[model samples]
Target: MNPNVTVINPTITEDKESKIRVAAYCRVSTNSEDQQNSLITQMRYYENFLSDSETERLVSVYADEGITGTQMDKREEFQRMLKDCRRGKIDRIIVKSISRFARNTKDCLSVLRELKELGISVMFEKENIDTANITDEIMVTVMGGLAQEESASISNNVRWGIRSKMKNGTVKFHSAPLGYDLYEGNLIINKREAEIVKSIYKMFLSGMGYDSICRELNESKVIKNDKGTKWLSASVRYILTNEKYIGDSLWQKNYNTSMPYRKVRNKGELEKYYINNTHEAIITREEFEKVQELIEQRKHPNMNLINNYPLSKKIYCGKCGSLFKRRFKNEKSYWICREHYYNAENCRTKPILEQVFYTAFMTMYNKLKANYSVIFTPMLTQLQELKNKKYGSNKQYIEINKEIAQLKEQTHVLARLKTKGFLDVSKYIEQVTEINAKIEKLNRELRKIVRCDDEDEMIEQIKEIASIIENGTDLMTEFDDVMFESLIEKIIVKNQTEFEFNLIGGLKFTENSIDNCT
Candidate 1:
């Protein structure tokens, strides 16, 4: 909740005179602390926006932080003003824009209806939208829908663009694992770190299981990935299986077309693109081929190695017991028996949708929720640790270290070039952008450090979600698609009676006997 600002009720000395007791309201949806400037700018602009209001005015500023425009009920400031309006305290609300007011049609109408009943007016500056005029509601309803669609389109385009880049091998994982460093601006081949990669590869090749390799890496006192911690088998397998090392990019492995929150994986249904040969290779083609062969065999070259895709390895046709490779057709995703697609009589069942299986599995979502509630806690703890330690690291300290290193290296190169007379002062100044980039990164990282409270804000989101769910029954009679999607992933229709559903996070699933279990 933002600070509750009170507007000093203006002097009504003259019976016929109208007075303006005005205040401003501003909002920015991003959780970024950098948006502080933007919010301030908007508030100040609104203060000026109502400067010449000649009517009876009682304006006060109400703000919501990192809040969505899709809904109005979650906004504490907006709701507070509504309460004030109900008590006949406020006369007008000054918003910066319609999008600031709402992106959802239903929310825009509901709030405007509330204010209309209270005879309170809302003025939006961007589209010159005013709630007082009854016609403005119609315009807002149409425009807000367009705005929401535009936002969704941009999100889809961005996801596609990212997948394309990944396919082209231009976009690699942001963090190179501990064993290798990204070199040549585009290639990852850290000599010191590469040794660890080689060690891991060797262990996998020699048949040492991933868990054993993790233990070995820890026991060897080797530095873990950028995240300072012990290695785990899952992480090891992820690295081992990543095709990035061999220079082939599998693009479009995931996509985020779903809305409200556009994360590719959390959504039960996401599309992925697979592109090949994106960058300089770290492992030889022969080595990559060998690894793939070993992967197919489900054998680790070392005694300590193990394969995680054991089931995938033995995915044979139910009828012929031949390999039933996964395949897709048209725009629909499915897994048909290869023999059937090739020779219809050779297969048992027809080509079935992978998503159908997923949906069937998800029919058990309600039963799974209880189990998820338990697993969510520990999973959240471990995930946060990994995100902070690996992705974030001692982010500030590491950023400074990088800047100092860049400055020293670039400056030394400039000195050498000067001594050899191969580069002039002008050339040195013009070509020092890498060093400048480092400085800029340093500044960004420094500014970010001041807003460590971001974590707290994220944690508090649980309460906000709970509040929404509590009010959901009253808000709408029907089920909310977004909330259900946010909680559940795909349900696997493993068989007619044995479908399995998965949750968004590492939530554990507890299966109960379904009414129509196969």
Candidate 2:
């Protein structure tokens, strides 16, 4: 029986041989014909390579076209591949090189470490480095650094070339602005869009703000850019400020940075080229200069507040909480809610006449003067009584202050305990958080008491307002800008026929505009 015994070699079963799930990632920075062909070739190569291997199963070939490799976030296909790997869809990743994976060294190692932790591996074909086989990432780090350096070098060269072209006035306009077309390396006026541009400038110069201009353009169904997008304030502002409309070109207004690649405004970080007569003029330079001056004037608070547009920042819409902008129609100034002016559907508040505001102020001031004692004296008494009630006994205030002091002492004790290792960090944090929350609630009660103490300030402001109203002319027959600016804080438009005058000390008085003012 011993002589007849035979050893049977174990046969490998099909179910025991598990194939590695593989995914390929490829990226081309540009969509040039050559790059497109390279991407297609890479896809075919990955397909054939995986198909020929019995131990590998092809999962997907992720390709990102016309995307920069320096920033991993910008590569959609690369991120998608990582997401799939995280979901355990693939066991192995294949990339052409470290540069294709990431030009950022940190991003490369971070992703590699994550994959290694998942028991997954990455093979860089050109570098002949497999993450699974390598004991450490020193070589990968060095290669990634070199790749980053190469990217920075290429970026510098490209930037230099662009600046050189800009200096020589040989740079081509790849895409023309809203008013022009790029033709033969020059900006040629596109008549249709140019008209829109002209209208925008005209409206802006004619006292229409950006929102109003955008609204008018959108209402007219005017196409903005080639995308036919709806007009926005930002787009209108760009059209207004762009020097291209004045037959000039300003190059390198924005430039790119290398390490963490991003485009930033030049802002004197680099030289900018300003060439004249680069295109036909959409608006005269004088008009453009005037528009610039107006923009500056409107932007300056002193100019808008004290010099021009007295009511610019003083009017509000009670219905929609929007500022009321001044618009002149038929030689009469009207104040309409900015939201209502832009889109009537958003806000239905009707425009109020500027004269109505003036008359409303006069009437409110007169009424205040007539019944100053009846109106403000009781208010002052009420405010004083309320203040006294809050701090009269001083018991609640004292208790809150005492508790806050005790909490502060407790915090100091906790800090000392933490410093001496008498209390663990987690317990200390919990105790300190509870103490601070109690201290915060007590502080809030203290703040309420302090606010009540502001009664004297309010009483003084009301007295000053009364004195200003009474010491002046007996009858306010004419609208006085000086008095209105001095006394009125804000005029809230309640509706088409009513206005609420919020006086300097927060006294609100409503006036009927339909009967007299309007």
Candidate 3:
């Protein structure tokens, strides 16, 4: 034996072999039948070709149809293919070309990098390029860059065509909001829907109330946003509030979130475009202005009316994740946080009146409803904690730890009463009912501090129900709490002073519910 070479015992170890699985991704963006046929042919060809090849094995074939390759998301087959690659089931991925893989440069490079890290290869048949090949990386980068440029070109071309149409007054938008429809590629009046729209406008201007309008719509079986569905006060108000029903169309209100498949709300970072006379007019400018006037009136402190618009439902208490209820004092309106309403532990937040803390809201509602312009501050305090007067400020968040002793005492009393078992079923029920009624009454009293208008119609409806059962009824009279529930959508009880609420959109006038206080 040579001095440098030494003999050693040979040892054999089992290799943990993974399955040589393969999956192919096929995509066709266009909805044309011919393109669809081409996709089917590609899928079948890959399936048969891989299965027939001696060195290759067919594991699965995922096909995404009628989805743009330029977009990374909204592609089921592509996602599945990537999933298999990550799960080690797919050792190789075969696609038609670089464009089929991804037209966006960053997306293609990121996906390629991931697969490369897993020792996987993507084969592009048209370019005759494989990730396993030495030259594939450089070629793919160039090809992917070209594909991305092409996608941008196509997008610009489409945008240009649409803009041209808009300039020529030929482009049309069919989202009628609620009161209008497309008539011969232009917006036109639908008589019945128009009447309802007009009614909402009148009610808003007169400050009748969103809850009343919602009840009226539901009673009249007004169609929902679409054909058949229940009406929501928010939806009803959205129709009344949307400006596109007039002649002006606001485009570019939002921007593309990502290169492929996501959209985010416009954060005012991008510029927006507005096109007038883009389509036929549904309502005249005078009518539109009149409707706006009504909206402004409802928001006015003097009107003291509730708005039934969809986006009006959100009133959050930054202190606790509770809703605030709307309140009215005299002719002025304010939103009261709900934590204070129920006397819950987290109720130390400050209160804001209509004339206080005006620098907060920047939404469309604030712009439309400019009722209180005084901008004074409030001095509401609970348990000796100060809170900001801003609508959604989270500055004074605190952990509440009060009322533990009271809760413990109540629990002990309940336990002792239950153990006694001396009372009959009806007597027990009566006792429990009395306690519950007391608690409910107390809670309502506390909630009254955070005023939420349930509209005159819903409030009266509940009163009518209570009136019909005036024969000195038992606890059954209080069993139906639907009136309270029907009137309030969500009461965000934020701290002790702030709260918010929304009224019900669909209401049946014949609906029966009981509340002791009308």
Candidate 4:
């Protein structure tokens, strides 16, 4: 018989105890009792389901209770599961539905792709689709899009209800504002807080600045915010500027905008409603308007009534590092160190003519423009390298995790040995302490590596700087204060004739003034 042809069936061996580890993910968007019960039910159902399957073992049940599906960062258990998945501790993930996994289409797809790369399978029960099943990918995408649209529809409906209430002046206030108490859908004056509000307005009109008013409130120790914190200048300012004190309701002064909703100051984004005499007045309308005028006057002190100049608060005295304040001398704008102008002992930096300063700034800015590519090229190249470079392999991550696990197991063994009188107590303590320290060091290194590996933020920063440069071709020809502000962080005046220009991208250049002091 030919030796190659004589074949017997080879006995294949496999780890019989090894089972596919399955983790169930559940989420509820609210802390309501009903939602909590539903969450508990999900946990129990998943536990029983996993327990009944002989081929599968329950590794973990990750549940994000009272967390919105829109925000993944807020889901602690969900993040932990992903971290575990990355560590190869999980083989499969099961979720109640795709909407429960993520409502955002992009978030859902991105997470699925990441999981796919890790060779992990996700089963969405409602969709009855397994991500490991390649044919269901299209269905998953379509369902994800539908879920996102559903989420957007819900958001829009909620917004419509809020806007309707706002337009009718029937909007609900979650918490009573300072000086007002919410009773039966109406704002009634809180006697104690109203007195404080009135005092804040009176003090402002009486020539006491916000700082002084805040100081007075603190010293009296009678006025405290809703949080029981001492009065701040900003808090005093809020009371001074609030039109609600004058019995007018300015609804929609701020509104939440965009997905992942951030509250933004309503600057003509939506229609604002101003309902007069909507509540009890803490201050008279005339007084409120007069205070507003006073505030405006303080804000815009120039003869032309400009609120702020290009370098209003950007100039810093090189010697004293104090902000240079704008002043007028013989109808000519000049900038002097505020500390030096107020108290000569604090700062003695001489004043510089605004015209002279601008000329010097332009000259330095022109020089920076001339060498823009040369100056930023090396820096940008390094950033590009960093952005393009592949981060450390997952092998290292796996190895580190394995080492951590081994260290943890050794610690447990040390405890057992000490308890059983098999090892010296001193040796156990010493070994455990040493292992813990080593583990901590490894953890720190791991965190550092992870932080460095994430180049998204760095890439964004680079893109932002690149865009500024790309759009700033005409930067040297004209004096655009906004552009100047965006690029230049601060202008340091070394002297009346010498200056340093500090750009936001960390490039600093010096220029000598050609104009002489008159």
Best by TM-score: 4
> What's the CA RMSD for each of the models?
17.0, 24.9, 22.8, 13.1
Ranking by lDDT: 2, 4, 1, 3
The C-alpha local distance difference test score for the whole of candidate 2 amounts to: 0.77
User: How accurate locally, in lDDT, is each candidate?
Assistant: 0.56, 0.77, 0.55, 0.73
Q: What value of lDDT does candidate 1 attain over all alpha carbons?
A: 0.56
**At residue 441, what lDDT does model 3 achieve?**
58
Best lDDT among the predictions, by candidate number? 2
Stretches off by above 4 angstroms in model 3 are 1-23, 30-61, 68-71, 82-91, 103-120, 126-128, 134-150, 170-206, 209-234, 243-289, 296-353, 360-518
- Give per-residue lDDT, candidate 2, residue 44: 69
Q: Estimate each model's TM-score.
A: 0.43, 0.52, 0.46, 0.53
Which residue runs of candidate 2 sit more than 4 Å off their true CA positions? Answer: 1-18, 40-51, 57-59, 174-176, 180-192, 211-233, 276-281, 284-290, 293-518
Q: Write the per-residue lDDT of candidate 4 for residues 1-518, one digit (tens) a residue.
A: 66666668747645434789899998887666698768767877887787778789888777777656678888877887999999999999999888889887778989999999999999999878888886456777899988777777776876788789888888756546799999866889999889888888888788765556766987987646422344544456667888889888888877776675655567686999887778889899899998888776654335223424657667898898889888878877788898899998887787788778667766766665667677667777787676445543466766787798788767756644553458886888799999999998878665555544435344444444445554454346544443454556678988778888876435577889868463
What is the clash count of model 3? Answer: 23
lDDT of 2 by residue, 462-497 (tens): 665665665555578877654665566677887887
Candidate 3 lDDT score relative to the true structure? 0.55
Clashes of each: 37, 0, 23, 0
